[model samples]
Target: MKRYTLSSLITRLASFEEALAQKMDAKGYVEAAERARRYASEIREIRDFIIVEMTLEPIETLDPMEFLDDAANPEEVDNLRRRVYTKIAEDVEPVSGELADLLRRLSS
Candidate 1:
């Protein structure tokens, strides 16, 4: 997996939002789209970098996203993982039942 610095991730999100807003602007929401585009452009202007690439295989033993915050509890941790994955991954799939059970048990 490719890992990125927080600023880099934020910048990527901003860029995506800006692109979407610009597309919507073509669809006629000129004012709202312009504001969104501006907000996203400001965020994208931040200095950012990708941090590293990691192998998190076996999908069971090693923690895949240990780089994320540790202070969050079980549910928050899961939510954070899901949200970040949704934002960053190019392809995603559901976890197997056994893996899901293992994760739930581990979090508890």
Candidate 2:
């Protein structure tokens, strides 16, 4: 089994976030949006699990400006945040085998 570090997970999550944004912007791309939502949920679950395991406080405030400083429209930032939060609230399947194995190793 392959091992994954926290930094790697964070990097992967960023990629997922970018993919989700692109999907959200694409016209008539329902399937892509669904896939992006799944990826968002997975990323959220992994992040929450790690925070709990590490006894870290959950981030309470997310400043969209931090990421969207160069964005042309402020509404786009709000839309992105809403989509991410909605995905996080939605029910998701249990973590995949690879992530499960990684968690097991981390907890060992």
Candidate 3:
């Protein structure tokens, strides 16, 4: 069995955030749509990365952002984000609240 280190997961999250900053070069209010797409892509990558690194089997996290349509509210977003990370945490090692906390930031 493989031993999952929390540091590695955390490092991966940090690296993802750094790369997100670099890739999202879309500036200003006019380019909001472009920025949203870039942001969504980065989030998807991080979600997939975390799921692959920490899961026991393949998990389908489908874009949580998709749930935040025109009718969705802030409470709905919070609930969806909470559920996604909670489900991930319930799966395997590095199963700490810290891991949950780190994963939660991916959508923020």
The runs of at least 3 residues in candidate 1 whose Cα sits more than 4 Å from the true structure, single-residue gaps closed, are 45-108
Q: What is the TM-score of each candidate against the true structure?
A: 0.36, 0.32, 0.35
Give the true-structure RMSD of model 1: 14.2
lDDT of 2 by residue, 1-108 (tens): 122344344444456555545645564455545655555565556655543344322222223224443323324434554543333222111323333443233223
- Output the lDDT of residue 72, model 1: 31
lDDT of 3 by residue, 1-108 (tens): 123344444443344333333333332233433433444455444444444454444323323333334213334434554654455444423444444654556434
In terms of lDDT, the poorest run of 10 residues in model 3 is: 62-71
Clashes of each: 0, 0, 0
Worst 10 residues of 2 by lDDT: 88-97
Predicted structure with the largest TM-score when compared to the true one: 1
On the 0 to 100 scale, the lDDT of residue 58 in model 1 is 26
67, model 2: CA deviation in Å? Answer: 20
**Candidate lDDT values, in order:** 0.41, 0.42, 0.41
Tens-place lDDT digits, model 1, residues 16-88: 4455455556666666467556656644443232122332222212223343343233344345445544433
